[model samples]
Target chain A: TQLLEQSPQFLSIQEGENLTVYCNSSSVFSSLQWYRQEPGEGPVLLVTVVTGGEVKKLKRLTFQFGDARKDSSLHITAAQPGDTGLYLCAGAGSSYKLIFGSGTRLLVRP
Target chain B: SQTIHQWPATLVQPVGSPLSLECTVEGTSNPNLYWYRQAAGRGLQLLFYSVGIGQISSEVPQNLSASRPQDRQFILSSKKLLLSDSGFYLCASDPGGEKLFFGSGTQLSVL
Candidate 1:
């Protein structure tokens, strides 16, 4: 069974602070995706990194896929209260399955 | 617009009771469907997936069973429920970009 490890299972920071969440895996994935889930709601897609060493940005959020495609990270710049939620990293395999990371619960207090 | 719908926003059931949750996709056909379970304040876990009609695949073996009776309809069922089964259930559809569009989700409480 493949596993994805996320750093800092829980995080709390004040507004205007920057935070980064990491997802590392031993197995290589075809692509990696980042999602943010709020309480009582399902996860919503944030971004997807397909190529190794690829970097994608969404406004204040940045995503990177490792050169070996076995790891990824999400960095939030100048975080705000609205950015607080569970950040999840998911990897897709060749067999059409998505392996999800345990998730990082982030709280940005104003 | 493409959308996914899951029923029973919230449920309360006693242990040993039967379980049934439904998920359906609209405005899209022949897409991949998936079922996930989220423990209280945790990430999503892939439980089942369907690529086509009658083709259901399970990722983790547990007390749950999934079926795809139609192209856009998926159902999660269990003959018996356990307290451990209490969680938030989500349904998602893939539109070929490796991104899964998720439904609003269902919160089940097995007392």
Candidate 2:
């Protein structure tokens, strides 16, 4: 099985601070997706990176796919209280089934 | 637009009770269906998936089983519930590619 490990399982930061969440694996992936899930709701897709060494920006959030497609990272700048949620990175495996990372729980204090 | 629906937003059942959770997709045909479970503070685990009617694949062997009676409908069941079965269950569907649309989810609490 391909395993994706996320670092800093939990993070708490004041508003306006910057934070980064890392997802790493030994196995290469064809594509990687990032999702944000709030309480009482299913995860919502944030971004999908398909190319190696790719970088995409969504507002204050920046996502990067590793050059080898074995890792990904998410960086949030000037974090706000509304940014608090569980962030998960998933990769497409066999049959296009998603292999999810353990997740990173981030709390941005106002 | 396509949408997926899952019923029983919350359920509390005693151990050894029968379990049934239903999911259906609308506005699509022959879509791939998936069932996933998320334990508290953990990632989502793929439990089962189906590509067509009467075609089901199990990712892990446990107390649960899945069935696809119709092309758009999928069900997750267990003859007898176990305490370890308590968790959040999510149903998702994909048309023919990587993007997956998920349902609201069902929170099962087995006591």
Candidate 3:
């Protein structure tokens, strides 16, 4: 079974602070995706990285895929209260099934 | 672009009662559909997936069952509900490549 482990399961920071969340796995994936979920709602796709060592930016968020495709990271620059939500990383392997990480809950106090 | 629609935003049922959750997709045809269960503020556990009509794949063995009655419709059912079955159920669709589009989710409470 493939599993994705996320670091810093919970984070609380002041507005304007920078934070990074990490997702790691031993198995390689064909693609990785980042999602942000608000309470009582479904997760929204943030970005998808298909190539190794790839970096994509969306507004204040930067997503990076590891060189081996076994890990990914999300960095938030100057996070705001609006950025507080549960962040999840999902990896798609040969089976086309997405294996999701445990998720990191961010609380940005204004 | 694909959109997933799930019904009954919240459900409260007894342990021995039956269950049925419906999901439909729009803006795409013959899309890959999936059913996932999530704990409170946690990750997603894939329960079933269907690649085409009348095709279903189960990732785990439990009291739940899934079916695809139409090209864009997926249904999850159970003869009896369990306390462990209480969770947030989400319906998702894959528009070919692997990126998923998810529904608002249904919170099932089996009391």
Candidate 4:
């Protein structure tokens, strides 16, 4: 199994603060996807990084794929109250299955 | 545009009861389908997937089983339900690319 471990399982920060959530794995992945999930709802895809060392920006959110494709990161700058939710990173293995990280719950206080 | 639909947004059933959850995709053909279960405070666990009709692949060997009788429909069923089966069930599809489009999801509660 391609295990993706995300750090800081939970995070609480005041509005305008910056934070980074890390997803690491020992096995290389062909692609990695980041998602944000709200309570009582399915996850919504945020970004997909296919190439190594690729960085994509979605508004205030920045996502980076590791050079080795074994890790990824999600950074939120000047976070707002609307940013609170559960963030998950999924790595695609050789098969069709996606190995999901444990997830990180973040709360941005306004 | 394409859309995925999962039936019975919320279900409450007793233990040892039969279970059936249906998912269908519209405006697309021959897409990869996936069934995932999400426990509270955790990530998604892939239960089953299908590349085409009657081509189900079980990611985990357990009580739950999935079937794809048609090209655009996937069904998850079990003869007897377990308390551990209570969780959120999600269905997704990806025609191409690594990204998947998800359905609204089904919340099943086994008592």
Candidate 5:
């Protein structure tokens, strides 16, 4: 089975703090996606990184795909209370399937 | 614009009760459909996926089964429910571009 292991299962930070979440895997993926899910809601797509060594930014959130396509990272700059939620990294698989990571629950205090 | 809808919002049933969760997509045709389950504090588990009508692919072996009778409809059903089946179920549609659009999940509580 393909597994995406995420680091820092839980994170608690104050407003204006920056943090990075890592997702690593032994298998390579065609692309990687980052999603943020609030309580009681399904995950919403944040960004997708297709090319290896690619980097994309959305407002305060930055996503990077590893050169080997086996890992990815999400960096939040100056996180706010609105950023508090479960952050998930998913790798694209064949037949339109996605393999998701365990997730990182971020708590940004204001 | 395309939208995905999953119904019942929340359900509570006794073991051995039949299970039926429906998902439909609007404003799209021939879209890829998917069913996923998320345990509390866990990641999404791919249950089944369908590329077209009457086509379904199972990702894991369990009591659950899925079907796509129409171009834009996907159903997840079970003959018997176990305590392990209690979790948040999500339905998604592939809107091309390798991105998935998810609907509000259904929380199933098996008693």
Candidate 6:
């Protein structure tokens, strides 16, 4: 079974702080996706990185795929109170299944 | 674009009771449906997936069983509930095999 490991399982930061969450995997994936989920709701896709070393930016959030497609990272710049949520990384291989990371819980203080 | 609909936003059931969770998809035909369970503040564990009608794939063997009666409908069932079954259940659809569109999710508590 494929597994994705996430770092800094829980994060607490003040508004305007910058944070980076890492997702590492021993298995190579064809594509990687990042999602943010609010409490009591399912996760919403943030971005998908397909190419190695590719970086995609969505406002203050930036996502990067590893050079080997075995890892990924999500960087948030100047996080706001609204950014407080659970961030998840999911990687898809040749199969239709997506293996998910343990997730990062971000708490951005106002 | 595809949308997923999951029912029973929250449920509380006693042990040994029957369990049923329904999920349906809209705006897409022959989409891949998936059922996942998540622990508190953790990642999602894929329980079952269906690629077509009457085709169900089990990822983790547990007390859960899934069935796809229609092209857009998926159901998760358990004959006897367990306390360990309590968690947040999410229903998702993969329309393009790229990204997943998730429903609002259901919270199931087995006491």
Task: Point out the higher-scoring one by lDDT: 5 or 6.
Answer: 6
* DockQ of candidate 6 compared with the true complex: 0.94
What interface Cα RMSD is found for model 6? 0.4
TM-score preference between candidates 1 and 3, better one: 3
Q: Give the runs in model 1 whose Cα sits over 4 Å from its true position.
A: none
lDDT measured at residue A110 in model 6 versus the true structure, 0 to 100: 94
Report the lDDT tens digits of candidate 5 across residue range B1-111.
789999989999999999999999998889889999998877999999999999999999999999999999999999999989999999999867478899999999999
* Segments in model 3 whose C-alpha atoms lie over 4 Å from true places: none
Shift of residue A96 alpha carbon in model 1, Å: 1.0
Indicate whether candidate 1 or candidate 5 has the larger lDDT.
5
Give the DockQ ranking, best first.
6, 3, 5, 1, 4, 2
Residues B1-111 of candidate 3: C-alpha lDDT, one tens digit per residue: 678889899999999899999999999988889999999989999999999999999999999999999999999999999999999999999878668899999999999
Off by over 4 Å in 4: none
The most accurate candidate by DockQ is: 6
Interface RMSD of 1: 1.0
Question: What's the lDDT for candidate 1?
Answer: 0.92
- Model 3 global lDDT (CA atoms, 0 to 1): 0.95
lDDT of 5 by residue, A1-110 (tens): 89999998999999999999999999999999999998888899999999999999999999999999999999999999999999999998664789999999999999
- The DockQ of predicted model 4 stands at 0.74
lDDT of 4 by residue, A15-83 (tens): 999999999999999999999999877788999999999999999999999999999999999999999
**Candidate 5 regions off by >4 Å?**
none
Candidate 2 chain B lDDT trough over 10 residues, lowest sum: B94-103
Docking class of 3: high
What's the TM-score of each model vs. the native?
A: 0.97, 0.98, 0.98, 0.97, 0.97, 0.99
